[model samples]
Target: MRRWRGRFLARLRAIAPRYPPRREVDRQARADMAASSVEGGLPGRRRANPSMLPRRIPLYRELIRATFQPE
Candidate 1:
């Protein structure tokens, strides 16, 4: 058990830089993509759907549209 654990840790250290954990790499990649794809200051996650806006509040909808122009 001790030998296996040591080997595992050694292997992990060796591969840490060459191949970081998938989830972390994916998250960083997603952040980069979001930054590059941004039309305004807002990220991809905050993208608003105009159709979802309430019909009763046209002013608020217009403000949102003015703030976030489509790319």
Candidate 2:
């Protein structure tokens, strides 16, 4: 679920910057991604915290676009 959302978001971000400045949004997105990559407790049971998804969607969309649609 999380991964899927990330991919989706990366695509969106890749398209065109909407809210705020791209620089600020990009920086914040990267930080959010980092926060969601931690190994939670329990075996075969990873959990994504509330704040972990601040940039998963948009960031994912942007990532997809960037890798595939280069200028």
Most lDDT-accurate candidate: 2
Mark the 10 consecutive residues where model 2 has the least summed lDDT. 37-46
User: lDDT per residue, candidate 1, 1-71, as tens digits?
Assistant: 34434543454455546555543333333333333333223333355643322332455334333433343
Model 1 spans with C-alpha error above 4 angstroms: 24-71
How does model 1 fare in lDDT?
Answer: 0.40
How would you encode candidate 2's per-residue C-alpha lDDT over 1-71 as one tens digit per residue?
Answer: 36644664565465545443323345445434543443222212435445544435566557544544535
TM-scores for all candidates: the values are 0.30, 0.27
Clashes of each: 0, 14
